[model samples]
Target: MNKMYKVLATASILALAAMPVAANAQQLPAQAVQKGNANKQTDVKNVPATWGQITNFVHDKSDKFITVTGRGLAPTDQDEIVLAITPKTKFIDAKGKTVPLQKIIDGHKTVKAFYSPNITKSIPARGTALTLVVQDQSFSAIDGKVTEVRDGRILVKGTDVYDKHDEEIWLHFADKATIIDQNRKTIAAGDIKEGMSVRAFYGPAVAMSLPPQSGTNYVIVNTNMEDVNPGEVNELTAGTAGVITDQKDGQITVIGQPLEKGGVNYVVLSIDDKTQIVDEDGNKLTKDALKTSGHVEATYGAVMTLMYPAHTHADKIVVKKAESVKIEGTVMPSDRTSKDQVYVNVGSDDSTANDVILNISKETTIIPALGGDTALRAGTKIVAFHSPVMTKSLPGITSAEVVIVTSDKDAVQPK
Candidate 1:
């Protein structure tokens, strides 16, 4: 019996795939078939690839699959009939996998070619203050929000559009429809507000056009730590302020906070270093992480930064002096050997550059400037101070100072 079922499934799929365009042409005219019309088109040839409908019977059992059998107006080609099912949020796959109501709607199929009005490509905006009469199903006032609406297209962000108590509805926009707000005014999208009432009109039911199979899962990294080390993992509390920017098997791009002008940048840590991150439940994770904006308190290791991680064979990194830090000095040659470190000469009076080795964190490493010597020249004046020495090593000054190129008294003009 199992083998027979597999064969039937394969045959059904093949029949649906092989359906010709001519078959759909014959049934387009009979779309207005009344609910109880005896002459309703039953043939699978008349149905479009996408259609919609609600379930006549709600199944409550270990196997949540519904046995859908409907009589069409005409005899449909064996594979021409398609059946799509969308169950409540509580529905789960046979494998015990959690299935969102949206996924069920997207994967619905028809047993015969004639389209089902219940399974549609368009989803309606949600609302609990209005009446929704589509096909033979009538749903009274349901709470929902208009997430998107543009030219015959609309999406609702709320629960209970479908059988699922918390499922949202994605419907098409209808310009001719009347929307009477709570204030009793027929307003536009701009006039929409919280707790507004809504309703929708329909032409033909549409369904999402996608392959029969499913896709793979994508990764996303959302954190609160900003100015973070390039590869160091940081902890970001869960909030709308966080976002995922990149996706991979194990890693994803995330961004937070808005960029400010003339602001400073700092590094929290580096890559290949493990830090403690936590899931929503407060469980910790030891992994590499990155952050774009917001505040995150985490312990991370130093890895390659936007610049050289350190003074190794990697390319040189450019370090800019902050305005608050002053620079004044005369050119003098000195030697130093370190891959990720830079040696700068500061006058005794210089407060910022008093420190020899500036730690820019593992994310950023100091390298020789293009066509420049290894050590800072005597005449090169620099202002520096300690900040978040880990990632961004922007100098901070305790006292204002300056460094400038100097010539012998005999070679300089008196001011």
Candidate 2:
């Protein structure tokens, strides 16, 4: 099979920030400690607010001075504030139960932290945390395909998320487990079925098995086939690629890539207020933003509605990249002087063209089909989905999104 490339990134326009130096969260700077004291002008009546997803956390047992990054606590989103916790500080879970401070200090925990403002400290000084409210636990959400579902168990498969490789996990539900849909309606244990889309929030507990197993607690469902009788509905699955053809009010029409011989061209999508939309990178987007020119890949139910153009409700819609293009040839060594970079030969058997050099930064995603990028060698049949827009400088003329390695002499896209 030939290699296939699918670029996930658009033009880069990210900002730069100042390099950081570490500090203690417990024993904040003298200026911070002073301002936090009521005698030094600290006011609780008009305390500043900061709230956002907790990106990082530090728990210092030795120094007793815990120092860590602050989330958005101000009225507006603010990630610049510093927070320190002491024995006097309090921690609470979703149920308002007092959770250990040691439990709160972890990466990616959404929290609202209030700190003592008006600090007399120098630039970017750590502030004393007046009160911290944890909105969620240190739980991670798993979005994937449910391969199996039983009374108390469910099996799902998806990318590792962190490592970007296919992985499978099993979830077991407790008798009193809490499970809800997008509308906050509680779902019955029997309602969840195989081949449905699920966004499972797992953590707080899991069996220490190879792939590990946990409770089927909270979930977001895209479709439910149990709504219809057999032979009355068609089927749709996850990762199916399509393009938004029309959208009005809340109804959406998509042109799915043909799947069967003499297949239908258009699909009618029922969009509710709860249906989620996002770009290829999983960033949330609005319904109006789904353009006719923009392609999409979605996860819906197998029970397709019997409409003029088969219909179904999309659980999740990931906009397919408009900037994606195919490139095939050999892997060329990078000679440019830069941190992360790679070059590729875009020539084919028909004609050998000029080598297209690509500059790879930490932001550039290199999805390998086989061995890692370092294994890419000269004369290797390579295929990549890269951006058509060329960079203004050297190192790389164009950047890549997804790169696949072809075996032997096959340049045809592999199934």
**Best lDDT among the predictions, by candidate number:** 2
Each prediction's TM-score against the native?
0.17, 0.28
Candidate 2 structure quality by residue, lDDT tens digits, 1-415: 0111122122210100010111112221112344545777532254554543343355556323333333232223233444555556656655557766656654445455665653312112345666566664333345677888755677777653222356576666544555555445677867777877776645434444545555444455656523445654434343345555457767776554434312333456777767788877779888876765356766566555322245668767777667355566776544553444456667644433445665554433333322123234445566665567876553347765444456433333334
Worst 10 residues of 2 by lDDT: 13-22
Listed per candidate, the RMSD to the true structure in angstroms reads 27.2, 22.1
Number of clashing residue pairs in every model? 73, 23
**Model 1 backbone overlap count:** 73
lDDT of each: 0.28, 0.50
Q: Which parts of model 2 are misplaced by more than 4 Å?
A: 1-106, 110-137, 160-166, 224-415
Error of 1 at 385 (Å): 80
How accurate locally is residue 156 in candidate 1, as Cα lDDT from 0 to 100?
43
